[model samples]
Target: MRAENTQPVDRTMDIETLMRALLRDVLGLSQDRVDAFDLDTPLFGALPELDSMAVAGLLTEMEDRFAILIEDDDIDGETFETFGTLLAFAEAKAGN
Candidate 1:
């Protein structure tokens, strides 16, 4: 078998980092705070920062950053309820 170290991501950009950038762009939060936020954090209800306008801005930012189109119907609360869920969805969208 080949060595596990042989991979492209090491030389190339990481999707998680890109997702974080998108998050920063959308959420208007610092990178440190974004890193601190975990996978299961209550987004809309608990997080006061995630207002309806902010959510819409985030959706637009994510679509632009990831080079993917998002329909209005795809804007589900569960998708942005946490960092991990959003990362996974972004990964799936970017075909990573």
Candidate 2:
């Protein structure tokens, strides 16, 4: 019998959902607030809750939940600029 792989697959939708939940949990955002987020939704400067310290916590949660490593050099203003960009960065790191 062949053994099946049990590793988690990083689907686009899954990543999106996870990202939304992460934002809510880490930043103490309301569900409605996060649900309203679309690809073009601005994140960093637009959201007062996502300041520098919150960003650190958010990144740590992202690493834990996504099982990925985020190096200091891997981030820039552009990565957290929008929901799409953040999702793209997560997808790339997750090998989706």
Candidate 3:
């Protein structure tokens, strides 16, 4: 009998994939555009699709998807600055 391989799964991929889906659905972005995003990619003012109107929807979507409550005071410009930052914030909020 061989020993079983045991390793903890990485949750980063799940968060990133979920975020891409949210971005695509909420902001109506193309799969190519969402796929092209990296950790350093700028959001907020940089993305024309992510405007004030879309921000609320995005936040709501995130809250619903992650089952996390995000207070008004919890978000700021920096929170939406990059894909990685948003993922990190969500991970923290989710206690993952």
Please name the candidate that would achieve the greatest TM-score relative to the true structure.
Answer: 2
- Model 1, TM vs. native: 0.73
- Tens digits of per-residue lDDT, candidate 1, 1-96, equal 776965665321476777667667666778897677666755676667778888788778877877888887766767877777777777777776
How well does model 3 score by local distance difference test? 0.90
| Model 3 per-residue lDDT at 46 | 93
Shift of residue 81 alpha carbon in model 3, Å: 0.9
Worst 10 residues of 2 by lDDT: 5-14
Per-candidate TM equals 0.73, 0.89, 0.88
Per-residue CA lDDT of model 3 for 1-96, tens digit only, reads 998867437777878889999999999999999999999999998999999999999999999998899999999878999988988898888788
Lowest-scoring 10 consecutive residues by lDDT in candidate 3? 5-14
Candidate 1 — which residues are off by over 4 angstroms? 1-13
Error of 2 at 35 (Å): 0.6
Candidate 1, residue 6: how far the Cα is off, in Å = 13
Residue by residue across 23-87, what tens digits does model 2's lDDT show?
A: 99999999999999999999999999999999999899999999999999999879999999999
Clashing residue pair totals per candidate (backbone < 3 A) = 0, 0, 0
What's every prediction's RMSD, in angstroms?
Answer: 4.5, 2.1, 3.0
Is candidate 2 or 3 superior in TM-score?
Answer: 2
lDDT top scorer: 2
